[model samples]
Structures are given as structure tokens and as C-alpha cells.
Target: MLSRMKGSKILITGASSGIGKAVAFELARRGVKLTLASRRLDSLRDVVEEIQSAFPEAPQPLIARCDVTRRKDVKRMVEECVRRFGGIDVLINNAGTGVYGNAEFTAIEDFRAVMEVNFFGAVRCMMEALPFLKQAEKGLVINITSVAAKHGVPYLGAYGASKAALAVFSQSFRSELKESGVSLMIVYPSYTQTDFFRNEKKVGGARRPRGPYASPQKVARAIVRAAESGKRNLVLSLEGKALTFSQGVFPRLVERAMDRIAYKLREKQEVFNE
Candidate 1:
């Protein structure tokens, strides 16, 4: 069984900001030694500084500059973490991107970019971490996905598709590693309060701001909880759970309801089309 709480070595990608950064803090409080990886070294330094100040007695966090889309970078990053902390007990694949537009209007290059970062990136990280995970007496992998994996969202088809693939991949991975010491977890978060929209590329419509979004801190806490408990899958927020259940119980009905809602919401704004 995966041990609860801290004293384990944990690594998180996309650690520069938002959910990844919040998770770093959450794990810090639990006393886990962390290796934070992202493309931005400056942002990573800031997070390290904050955590160092908060937990002066704990080991200083190891910071790595990595773009998970690159397999070589991910391999090196995992190797470095293993070298520093001995071996990884938890690996959180949280880096992803969103692309918005109709399928016809969406650029093929943009959709590919989303898949590379959101899907293949997680795949590479998982592969790179596998050996270290296997070496550990207990290991966990958490992939941060979205509710779009279950219900299609307007103009978020590419983003949703990427997450859907990750969810499926995680399910297969979980079963494949059933007898192994490593645990696999995939998380589906509903809209969350992050810079996701600002960072995303908007195409074929005006970006419609959304409300009732979950907080990054809340999502981060869920991730840490899943990692500690060795949960197989987690859907964050009541809204996400309800929507997923609707999809399961009444697939066509839920799809039609979502289609109607999207049309009504975006009709006047020209913000999206299914």
C-alpha cells in the first residue's frame, strides 16, 4: 500500500503556476521532498523561495527546467530527481494546453500542438518515471485531466479530446500495472480558476469567460490526497461528478442538453459553435 502523508519524494510538472504551484505548497506542508519541473526556471525559483521560507527545516526543493513535450527533457528531469531525492515516490503529470475552435476552422497544427503537450507529454513523463517508480516500494502517478473528457464542451473539442485520450490511457495503464507497486491516478477537474484561458489560444470565436470554476488550491489538494491514498481516479467538484453521472445514465439526453445550453449561451456572443 502507498504510504500516507509525507517523507516521500514527489515530482510535479507544470509547477511554475496555478494547480502545480498550489500542490507544491500542499505537499510541503505534508513534509514531502519535492522536485518541481516546468519550462520557466524563474517561476520555479519563486515557488522554491516561498516554500523554503515556509518550511526552513525541510530539504530545499530541486528545480528543473523542462518542457514535458520533449521526451529527452522528461527523461533527464526524472533522472535528476532520482539522483537528488534517491527515487520518486510520486509523479504528477499536470502539464497541458487548451485549443478552442470548430473542427473545420481549427488549425491542424494547433490541435496537434494541444495533443503533443496534453497527451504525449504525459505519456513521455510517465514512461520516464516508470523505472524510478518501479524501484520504489510504493509509487503513484497522477495525470491532471478535465471534465471535458466526459462531456463535450463547445470550442474545446481539441482540448477535450486530448484529455479524453489521457483518461483512456490512464485506465489502461492502471490495469496493466495492477500487480506492480506503482499506482496510477487520473483526475478530471471541471472549470478551474487558473490562467488556463489566458494561456490558451482562442480561435473562431470570442472567448467566453466562465464562472463557478473550482479553485486551483482545491484541485491541488485533491491531487495530493489521491497521490497519498493511491486513488485510481478522481473527478474534482460536484459539478464534474454530476455531469459525468448524467453522461453515464442518459448519454444522448445529456449530450443534447449540453448542446442546447451551449447554443443558447453562445448564440448572441458568437463565442462558440458545436
Candidate 2:
């Protein structure tokens, strides 16, 4: 079923910046009522102002300070959405943190922290909003994950694991959501030109992959299209699509490539060893 954007009450996490912020703008432009949640209230205010400036006639966005890792915060945020918008028609789980380092050197605690936000954070939001979502004409849940969720990269294993966990969990939960009006969509975004790298925890000297990163604005547009078209899984970028195909067709070859990448990264990053 096609999801309606206009008039829908939407809640987007991590909307202070990056993909989440971009999505908020896109939704607002479509006349959807928005509740933008992030730890940075000031940044979210800026986003609201920008959106209002872009579309004066559109619905103004409501900003909430939310740290997805906390159960109480997530609950309060969702309730605020319902109180303000009546009910949530769409939930975009875009809040996430990253850990940049090799598996061996990356602290287990770092992995846990990422998982708390990237995985459990989404879970908390869904659990809280499912009831409200089910009441809507066609409720939508968009899980903004990553390409790392699809393939385990060298330095991104920790981050990947977090997204991968969310992706895997989404599969089962989606099935359970069958017969329910609510629908789930998982978005696997590739490297994007975002501050994620600079904001991420750097455990060791790992040279980041040289990549053609996708812009958050571009990704946001794709997500909006997918939402309207009711696409189940959205994989952005040709490289990600190719990797998905290659993994299935040539599993051994893919493993070999990853091995080579791991070697290169380890060798290249040694120069910056701390």
C-alpha cells in the first residue's frame, strides 16, 4: 500500500543534523506535521527555522530533546509526538553513533554504546509508537541503517554490527507486523558526506576509505520517494547494490576482497598509530 505523506504526523530521531535533519525538511515540504528529536535542541531549532524559511506555508516542526539510548527519554519523546500531532503516522529511526577502529582494538564498550543508539534506540521508539502507528490509516516505520549493515567493512565492523543487528531485527519484527496496518522499511545508506567520521570515536589509526560519499540531501530525497512507493528495503548507491549481488553470487570472492581491504587498512593506518 502507498503511504501518504501530507497531513501525516511524523517523528524523526536525530533530526538535529545529518540524514535525520534532511528527512525532516523533506517531510515538512510535503506538508507533514513533524516532531524532530535529538540531543541537540539548539541545532534542531535551527533546522525548524530553515524548514519554515524554505516553506512558509508548510506545517511548522516541533523540536524535542531526546537521547534515544534512554528508555525514559524515548517514551517521553513519543508521548510528546502523540500529544502534539494526535497520532504518529510515520516513525523515522535515524539516530545513530559510530565507532571507527579495528575489531580487536575497539573497546567492547564502544560497540555497546553504538548498539544502544543504532539498534536498541530504534527498538525503544518502535515499541512505544507501535500502538499509535497501528491506529493510523497506514503507519510507516523507516529504519535508517547503513551499507555496513549489509557488508562488514574493516574499521566499520563495530558500527556495522550495530546497524546489522537493527536490520536483522527489523526483518523479524516486520513479519510480525503482518496483518497490522503498520509497515516497515529499512534504508541502507552508503558512505555519505557527513560529520559522522569526525564525530565518531577513533580507537586506532585506521585510514578511512576513500569514497564517493552521497549527500544527506540526496539520500533524504530517495527515502521520501521510497516511502511513497512503499519499497521494502532501500539500498542507495551502485556500489552497495553491486556488493549485495556479488556477495550472493560470489561469496568466496567477496570474502577475499574484504580480506584484502582489511590488510590494506591495517598497513595504511599503521603510520598514524597512537
Candidate 3:
């Protein structure tokens, strides 16, 4: 378990928007020194300015450029954060992308791209941050996986697979880092109102939004608390948790049920678009 945020040096990737941006705000309120990273420097600067204005007394956050898909960029971001803050207390691998496509029809490149951002991207960040994480008196790693990780969905084939891989990686990585005094937590978030859909790649065209989704701020608060509590893994949303648990306990039945739902959703989207 780690101490509650008093003066922890934290780095959050994808900090320009969504859960990452919200987490940055919440952490700043708690007096954590932040190193906010994203691909967009302008957005990063905007978040930094917003937070600084809100918490004028707090330490100004460092905004670093990071493209999670590029290993070198991830390393540079971590190194820059360490240079700015001395060492990293917590690293949140929150940068990811999505794709909406059927398994058979989904281009291999698209699947690889999703995997690069959602899975390998996290891996790159973790690898780069490992040195500084080891240096911290107490270390935490939070991988922002998705609820789709535990369950199958049709349009989100590649995105789901990537998040599933991330969950598995976090589980395994947690085991390895436990004895090293580094805590790793996998956060499984259900659909949330974020820019994910805006930037999400389309399969046939016009991606569909289905089921329950929570606010990003709510999930961000949960993440900060999870880090404070040193939770191993957390799943947000009641419906999402139920679906994940059901899938795990009865894989075949859930798969069958979801298959029917996926078929219906695809048909619905096709009809609606036409």
C-alpha cells in the first residue's frame, strides 16, 4: 500500500483529455506534482495552464510530449519527467486508441495499430518508467485497460483484444514487481464519455455507441483512490463489473449471448446508416 497523495511525483500519459486529464486535476488538488504527457503539446499546455490556474499554490506540472506507440518517445517522456521531478512515484499508462471492425474484415494493419497504442504503448511507458519507478520510495503503475478486456464484443474486436492483452500484462507485471516494492494496478473502465469515439477508427463506417457509459471524472477519482489503496485490479461500473464476472464464470454462455448481441448491433448500425 502507498501513502495518500501528499507530495507524490506522478506522471500521467494521455493527460491532454479524458480520464488522464481528469486524474491530473484530481491529483493536483491532492498536492501531487504532475508530469502530464500527450502527443499534442498544445493540449498538454492547455491542461497545464488550466490546472495551474485552478491550483496556483501547487507545483507547476511538467508537460512532455509522448507518443506511446514509439518506444523512444516514451523513454524521452519518462526521462524528461525524472529530470523535472527527480523521480517518478507513480506512472499511469493511460494513452490508447480504438478500432471498430469485425475480426475477419478488420485489416491486419488496423489490428496492429490498435495493439500498438493500447498494448505495446503501455508496455513502452512501463519499460521507460521502470528505472524511476524503482527509485521511488513507493512506486505505483496504473494501466488504463477497458471492461471489454474481459468480455467479447463484435465491433471492438481489435480494441478489446488489445485491452485484454494489457490486463494480462498488468497482472503478470504486478506479480513481478510486487517483491520489488512496486505496485501495479489494472483499471478496467466501462464506456465513458471521452474523445475515444471521436478518434476511434471505423470498421465499415459510422461506429456505434452501445450500453452504459460513465463520466471520465468519476473513473479518474476511482483511479486516484485505487492508487492510494494499492488495489491490484479494479473494474468500474456495476453493469460492466457484472458482465466481466459473468463472462469469467461462464465463458461459453456469455460468448453465445454476446454473439447474438453483436449480430443485432451490426444489423442495427447497417440499417440505421442506410
lDDT of 2 by residue, 52-137 (tens): 99999988788889999999999999889999889999999999889887677777799899999999999999999999999998
Q: Sort all candidates by TM-score, best to worst.
A: 2, 1, 3
Best model per lDDT: 2
The 0-to-1 C-alpha lDDT of every candidate, in the order given, reads 0.85, 0.88, 0.86
TM of each candidate vs. truth: 0.95, 0.96, 0.94
User: Tens digit of lDDT per residue, candidate 1, span 1-274?
Assistant: 2236358898999999988999998888878889999999999999999999998877789999999988789988998999998999888898877887666678889889999999999999999899888888777888899998988887778999999999999999989987887888889988888888888888876565567888998888887777666677789888789888988898988889878866765776656543
As a whole number from 0 to 100, the lDDT of residue 27 in candidate 1 is 85
Task: Quote the lDDT for 23 in model 2.
Answer: 88
Worst 10 residues of 2 by lDDT: 265-274
lDDT of 1 at 121: 96
Q: List the residue pairs that clash in candidate 2.
A: none
What lDDT is reached at residue 71 by model 2?
91
The number of clashing residue pairs in each candidate reads 0, 0, 0
Badly placed stretches (over 4 Å) of model 1 are 1-5, 272-274
lDDT of 3 by residue, 133-250 (tens): 8988888899999988888676677899999999998888888887887888889998899998889887767456554668899999898888778788899999778888888798
